[model samples]
Target: MDFSSKLYSIESELTQEDLDSLKFLCLDLLPNKKLLSIKSNLDLFKELEKHSLLEEDKYDLLAELLYIIGQHSLLRILGTNKWAMQETLKKNRTVSLYRQMLFQLYEDLTSEDLKSILFLLNIPKKYEENKKFLDILYYLEKNEQLSEDKLDVLEKAVSMVSQELLRKINDYKKTRVKENTSTQSLYDDKMKLSIEVVEQVSSQDRGMKSTVELVQHVSEAANGKDLMDKNTESCMSDLSLNEQSETEVYAMNRKHRGYCLIINNSEFMKSDPRLGTEKDADFLTNVFTWLGLDVQIRNELSTQQICDCLIDFKQRDQTERDCFVCCILTHGKSQAVYGTDNAFVHINKITSYFSTKNCPTLAGKPKLFFIQACQGKTHQGAHAIESDAVSSVEERKTKITIPDDADILVGMSTVDGYYSFRDIRKGSWYIQALCENLTKMVPKGEDILSILTKVNKDVSEMEYSKDRKTSMKQMPQPAYTLRLKLVFPIPLAPFKPLFQETN
Candidate 1:
């Protein structure tokens, strides 16, 4: 199936009317520009006015028209002159539509419009229902174009919309049930199935919301969004005290030191070296170092050596250190990672050392582990006809096991029963995506979990084929029991353009 095509179709369904309104609005908003194009602005506006008068639900259409007018002014300021407009048209792209529409509306968008959109967002909402609109607003906000007053209005609007929508939905359902009793059995069956599906969706939504809330609280505390005057003890007991004080007790001192250990055990017994493991170690080391952590890279370490390193790191002084990250790059079999000596070690032994009871220093801190190894012996190779000439090698055993209390986040390269990709000269597919995602997300105030989620998405979308003709897919999975959110410093924060005006 063409997933992209299906997604486009669905998006079209949602935004069809919006798009039509946008086109009509653009004609009025960009009269001079429209005069330069094939369509006459006057004719289009006349038709739109007629349609607006006849339509019962004209608010959205009017809003779109106003938004287009705002966008036209912003575009002019952004130096999108006649030539640029013509170029956009030649490319067969609609310049003032969807995400692009927000840019055009940026200059003329009023506080009310901003509030209306924000109000829609503040209420209980599904991201899918309004992601595009939110994306546009976020873009404008990021550009320092959105006023604080507008943002406040938007927030209240979102809350109000959410409440109103909920009430309307409930009322509609009740009325439909009462008025359509003749088709009761059919309705009953449909409603029963709908309720079951909605329940599942609600459960998933709750899980996501809980996760997001935890991350948001952590971010706010870390970024000084809610700082407290008192220390940990007083802040925890006092309702008036801000939560930042409590979080500060567990915060990683910026000046404090931390270490990273990278272990690569790619070679199996009588097997050639695997570059994927080496790349995993290298990528992880770079990421940690970028985050201001002292890093040590080790290759071809035996299982015992790996264990000893973790034990030593756990014994470090809490006041002088921050967090620890361990990256294991190796070939494996079922819940275990392999060492250079062909030794089998359970992953739990490496992680268990940093638990609350074992390592007091890292008790409430974050401990991250990136594992790039096979999880099982099952081979998922391409068929002979479509497969590459490369012959399949015998499956190897994994030696390391992970512990339950490790407070460690493990990001595995691929799901079990699948082969991870590695380039002989470069690195593994997972490492490339991991590096890219970390580089992008870390600067955007995203937590470790959010970054990992993006990495999972990138890996899932990538396809690998054994022979040039066959396709096999592999996706990475990040499993974590993190007690705290990990926030890396943004290197370019000081240079960001600041907002000067309020709505």
Candidate 2:
């Protein structure tokens, strides 16, 4: 044989080590055939058939491997053989059925939800079949014909898909967890602690074990189990002097720390009209609250109102709190966000309030700022590191001096000068991605910087644009000055007693 033919022959041979490893794919799932007969990748499928007796994990592993292998082979054989082309055409129909099934399961999904879900599942949007899935979803939602039952099914499917993608992303994340592996703990790594309580309570109780079911249960319950305004008040009410109890110190202690301040500016002066910010505020409030922070949400604040709020938060006594987070959802050009009354508040002005010299209570704490407004009024021609609503393009680096002991992290939705995209119904892309990843990563013990890095990846990969002919892309930017790692601890249980008598 010539050199090329020899190379092919060598590639087709199964080495001893490979044979040893292949056994883990399961002998039962392997077809009854000679291993040497497979001269090309296309023919490998004939040896990868599964038997009914095989365990589920082995079967799944074999299936995933075979699917990948077959995909490669099919691309190599594209249009070469008449029979092969015909078979591939038939398989395309199967993929169509699967896509249709996904839509049927989540009928009420908005266009934005469909896009976010696909990205969350690591599904590729390049394929025509996937594009059709989105096209149909957009149409149905526009017509307001999607069903609630289907929406429920879609959420479950999205959760399953995320878990599957995460596993596939890590080679060591096998289908079966080893008995001695520490990963086999009683928790799903993706769950936030508050959501975990809701889930486990429902499961051990045998009534429900999911976010949706538990929320519905609370709403249906007779007592004041309502989680929104009422529970949030209970969380904040501890700060009041009149409501102070002797046992309060055990729960929250004397320090007014661990609060998430969300400033949502949806309405704007007639000069700069925008939509969909309110959606972001609502979702973020729910998420941070579920993450165990006492949330303070305000909407439609003007420039002065914005300043006052941050100053108040900065002045709070945070001795016992571990960290502080502030989120802003609004519109603006470079270097500032617009208050509801159309006034500009420089981003630094809001953040500077937390400096060690200014807010001594938060001197060493991690003060995080999440801004979801367009920084400038320019686009990088489909390739911009940008933020929410709309912004221009410009690269800026400014250093302001502060006291020696200060810790801060500022997360901008985009780079200095580009438009930040948001769906009229779904909210800004950055905030949604941020909330989901925080929920997914925090329970698994990921640090703040690592979690923000994932948020950057998640937002950057998603394709967003005002029009399809010229699609847009976004890349988030994080700037921080810290003396130590900022890892928000998981609150395993409720702080019921609130406080205790000092020593």
Candidate 3:
């Protein structure tokens, strides 16, 4: 009944290949360096236990991993069967989109077909030694000829090998296109709402001063109450009285854009030290500072310190500043992340600290939380989705009301119950993509949500496919309640800092 005993019982039922598959399924969940040394099921469980992912009462992750690798016979050791797992994961599968794609390709491709495709690819003859189709795909990824976004090289080679495989690739591309279109449509809806609000006001009052007056009137009339608080005032006042931009944006012209808090937890008391987080911290501090925000970095904090830090910010009077930003880089699990002491700090608790009731000053201002942590331990594998009839788009009437939780954005490194990846050498996939997108996209006037959409696409395309079995993938998730467009206009010149940088 104990956790180690359960793992030992499972180990007896598994062969070397089964163990390898289990480890492969865990590639996205566990550290690669630790996984390499897991020659037995017990060893793998030990690593999971170290991360607080497995316990005597909590063996669901282990069971899911076994089920994912098709070691179904071993599932009963954890008191679950394949049929039950099938139903449980029907709506929420753990295998990543990238992994499922490669697995499906391997299952359909013949050995001869692989050889022919490899020949067409003109891959080095040395790779000809690789017999598995997945191995060949790994080579393509390693050589930078294939990725989630780029499949031209594989598509061309596969076309000559088999039309079915080519169709599969095309289906995957269609799904990606549809997803992108859906995201763009959401952006368009927000923009439309902005335009509708403006047009409604413009129909009656055309001047810049009238625009502000109309916003307050329309909002009050639509909501049937006075909701124009200090935050709403800040949102509207960001626009110049004499000259308004073509599009409305949240105020970012203040000399100080409030605090950009970077909580970088690299060292842990129990868990593996997070390597390469220094790069994320450094990059965020520099970029946010350049964007006219006061950057503060806090390295290696316990759970108490994290709570204390949030309380400190929540209590601060941010009336003079324009917005707030917080970045958390650490190990995590479902709905919560770990501190240096390996304790849980629920994300709800963190976000609640900045609620309008909790922190009145930040009520209307944007409070951005960029969390570089995994939401869960599930691995996302790619799969083909059959095309369905497109539904007709509908437009709805717009109403503006500032809820208690408005102006908040939480950018998660991965979706719920999945892993987010990091390189020991180059920092995390989410942070790297996020910083890169912000640096590249902000100057072009894209709002934060749009920039985050680009970040989602960039991180999803990345894979740590060292080999076919250990191919890993990640997807970033963004959730926001922002009422107005949040854009950080590039300052004419980087503001000289007056505060000392803290490590």
Best by lDDT: 3
For residues 1-503, what per-residue lDDT tens digits would candidate 1 score against the true structure? 24333223323323343444344334324443442242433344344455452133332333234323322222222234322333333223322232332333433344555556655545335533443443445544555554422334333443454453333333333433433442454445545555665555565656666657655544444433212222222222221111121121236664654777777766555444564455456666666677777888877777787777777777887545777777777766566666766665676666788777888876667788887776655443432211101122545444444555645787888776556766544467777688777766565445677688878867787776766887767788777776666666554322221222122
TM-score of each: 0.48, 0.47, 0.47
TM-score winner between 1 and 2, please give it. Answer: 1
Q: For each candidate in the order shown, give its overall lDDT on alpha carbons.
A: 0.53, 0.55, 0.70
The sequence of per-residue lDDT tens digits that candidate 2 reaches over residues 452-493 is 998998888788664677677788888888666564544443
* Prediction RMSDs, each to the true structure: 21.6, 26.3, 27.4
- How well is each residue in 387-458 modelled by candidate 3, as lDDT tens digits? 100111222222222234888898988876667777665567888788877766564445798789989977
Query: Would you give me the overall lDDT of model 1?
Result: 0.53
Q: Candidate 1's error at 464, in angstroms?
A: 1.2
Question: Lowest summed lDDT over 10 consecutive residues: which window, candidate 1?
Answer: 239-248
Off by over 4 Å in 2: 1-257, 378-405, 491-503
Which segments of model 3 are wrong by more than 4 Å? 1-246, 378-404, 493-503
